[model samples]
Target chain A: MNAMLDAAWAVFVRELRLALRRPAEATQPLVFYCVLALLFPLGLAAQDVGLRAFAPAIVWVSALLAALLGIERLFRADVDDGTLEQWLLADVPFPMLVGAKLAAQWLLIAAPLIVAAPLIALALNLQPQAIGVLLLGLLFGTPVLVFSGGFAAALTVGAPRAGLLIPILVLPMMCPALIFGAGAVRAAQVGLSVEGPLYFLAAMMVLSLTLLPWAAAGALRNALE
Target chain B: MSGLSKRQKRMAAVLVLVLGVGGAAFLGFTAFSKNMMYFYTPSDLLAGAAKEGATLQLGGLVEKGSLRREDGLKIVFVMADCEKQMPVRYEGILPDLFREGQGVVATGKLGIDPVTGERTFVASQILAKHDENYMPPQVAASLKTADGKHSCAPFKSLGRPAENLAGKPMTAAAEAPRS
Candidate 1:
């Protein structure tokens, strides 16, 4: 009821507060995303035409990789400090609490990546209209990344040195999102209708947001046991 | 609404979310079903799937002897699906992999031949279809008849020209024959 929502709100607030406490952690993936995108213009000798041609792919790949950067730490700190056990014992539904934490991660991690993407895409010479489609693609695509990555993070929360394991486990599952996300931008850049890829991405985000929180909660229980 | 139990409210929210997403996906799928074809075959164009003057991708095998390279970069070729064939005219430096009897996809508009009043696909850009192992022309021709499997043949080792020349419009100087 109201109590569950209040508890979920409290957990979300706490997660955001913790992220603010370590501001570098929140900004690190964004910096990684920007740097990866910025490197393409320097490395490629071609002028604006070549850079613009590759802009959508570069921006999408960098965003996908950057999303992975913060996912490993998604549940690690709570597991380390025994806060996960407290969450399990709380009266609110455990999945709701996990969803709230993931929402916070999406805000702190994926949101920044999306916000910073247009700037990076512009640097790569992507057109303004294409940049709008790029933004929309990331808006729908990144939540799926966060939720799916959070599930992988949850699965590996108890594993020692699980840094590289999360991306390896989740990247294959996240391929469709990457394809549709990048395809939308490419279609827009080439003056094709972007609705198809954007719809697929939106469907994926809805399905992920609906289902992954419970899946992650189940994985957390397995790790706890 | 305020008196509803929390469980009922949760169900309502979940129902709304699912229905909303499902409706949007359904609408988009229906609206874009025509545009989403990877590339339209000659049969598709002949059947009137695309309107005249609208840009689209035309894909098929280049007929074995139908290639005519005019002066400069202008080339005319017959692109064939299993059921029908269409003539495509393009003015560009053909990709390195461009060859007769290989699969190709051209992006451009469908126009009418002014003299003959016949349909012509005027391509702005031409790309060689890239596949790992191409079937020979005979096998591809037979396969196209039997099961309608269009395989790119004879052009090996070339990456997709689409990727190489994406968003790079070539110079189209009205080189297509008027007749």
Candidate 2:
């Protein structure tokens, strides 16, 4: 148990260090997200109506894009430095390593998006009632993103043009997450029920948690070999 | 040519051959498939010979004032190609990105005599093509473009590994807090 914990912690610390080392790169998604949100008001004709109408999608799209922006680095640096091979060759199990990196990724990338979502919501003209749902939706959605991203990262680990491939493969899988997360906010924005989409989001999180790490590690092993 | 090692030359030659064959095959298939992914403008969709149960993708600006919510959960939005409008019914919450004016693409089987398209979409994948540069490189490059539509290779195709942008400057410091 202690060994497993150590491996996970090591990966988290390593990723965090890299993120801190290059603050500009690390913060790109958040900036992109906020800037894009600003476009809503300028582009639309009516602020009040457009704000209510566009709020759900703005939050989800920003979150999804932000998630994608952080993905390439998940394995790129490790592969270049030969560290990925070292981890695979090490005594620690690959799944644990996968788990740790995923956790770190969520903390570094997804966590920030969630924090920034309220600002996005405010920009989009979302009601206060819907803000909590947006946050919760992100809470559920980012894990699925991290899990799915791990698989894509593993698949394209050494593939040429992987930066482009990750988004392509990932956006398709993001359908369910986008639907449910945005659904929750839309439901609350106009005083509707939230149970169904929230449940769906929860289900996706549970499934991704249980299955994605192993699949991701398997992809990593394939790329490594 | 001057920098090439014999072993590296062999690898490069093999790569060129693979790329040539793969690119040819993809182009051939796309032509054969009638260039499957044509984004139907709202008016185009209505004018088309949309037979019952024919699978199709409708793309256009989401119509304003046409949004109707059922219990504030199920959403129906209009896709207008400025000439015609097709109704897209989505269950569950939408993304913060889904607004009336934005361009959207919805994929599903055409409803049976207009069966609300519910049962069909419920069992199928309804996705929006948010951007033109979306498909994975291999898939895009491999896809048959017979109809000559969807031929825009907007993304810098498969030149670098995904990580090239990881350390690229974000052009904004506000993206990540220093802490």
Candidate 3:
């Protein structure tokens, strides 16, 4: 357990450092989120009805995109710089290493989306109660996003067109999270209980936790080969 | 003709092998059409849908009122090109922007009904709304001007502003999940 915690912690630090090193690029998703937010009001003619109607989806989608944007770096950069090779050669077990990296990515990417959610929710004029649910749903959904992203990054670590291919392959798989995340929040906006959506997101997180990390490690090893 | 030295013969043979292999592979890929996604216009797909396990890409606009959930998980929608429609079944959640009248690209396999063997496809991936502005990294080469300035790649195609757009970096390109 100690060794596992240590490896997970190490992955977390390395992932954080990587993001902080290029704060501009690291913040690019937030930037994308901001830009996309601005687009809806401009494109949709800025009516409150349209904005409120689409708010949950817009927020979750942007957040999902933000999380996805940084994921390719998860394995690509490590592979390119030989850190992944070293990690594979290291004393730590591969699954722990993979889980650790995913945990780190969720912290850096999803955590920000959660923090930024309220402000975006306000901008979109989402209901106050809905904003709370949106934030919570994202909290659960983002982890799954990170887990799935790790899987994609590991799978296409070295291909020339991996950058493009990864998104095509991974986005479809992530639709579940996007759906539940948005739906829960949307449900709350109408005074409905968001329990189902939140539970669904939580279920996705658990399912991903059980299956995705091993898949990611297997892919990473394949990438290393 | 003069007889070639051993080294010259070896180099010539290597050159021949390269040309031969390259030619054969190129022919094989193209003849097989293995690399490009199999594209079916909405009408073509509806007319002769194939059996299951055959993957295809169908591009069209989402049909109005057809974007609803049957079990909150299974999404049934229709893709149209104004003149034709292909029924689409997606078993998971959909992209946020999936809506009526938006252009979409769906990827999945064909399924034939047991009773009639009539074919329909199951799309797992759906790209909603065709956008006007796209500047891929590779497009950078083509986007270059005589002055080395980047060409204006606008998002207007996707229903956005034409001006003040950065090559926009898609900055969102990396947002797809890794697995």
Off by over 4 Å in 2: A46-48, B1-179
Q: Model 3: per-residue lDDT, tens digit, B111-151?
A: 75343455555788887655564567576555543322212
lDDT of 3 by residue, A97-213 (tens): 788778877777778778888988888888897777887888878888888888998888767667778778778879988877887776577543456457656666766765677
The segments of candidate 1 whose C-alpha lies over 4 angstroms from its true place after superposition are A46-48, B1-34, B41-57, B61-76, B80-86, B89-179
Please give the CA lDDT of all the candidate structures. Answer: 0.77, 0.65, 0.67
Candidate 2 lDDT, A67-90, residue by residue in tens: 787677678778888887988986
DockQ-based ranking: 1, 2, 3
> Against the true structure, candidate 2 has what lDDT?
0.65
lDDT preference between candidates 1 and 2, better one: 1
Docking class of 1: incorrect
- Please rank every candidate by TM-score, starting with the best: 1, 2, 3
Predicted complex 1: DockQ:
0.12
TM-score leader = 1
* lDDT for each residue of candidate 2 in B1-179, tens digit (9 for 90 to 100): 13445576466546644654555455434322331224334443444434434455555555556767766676666655433456676676455656655555576544532446332222133344454445666665564332212211111112222244342322222222211
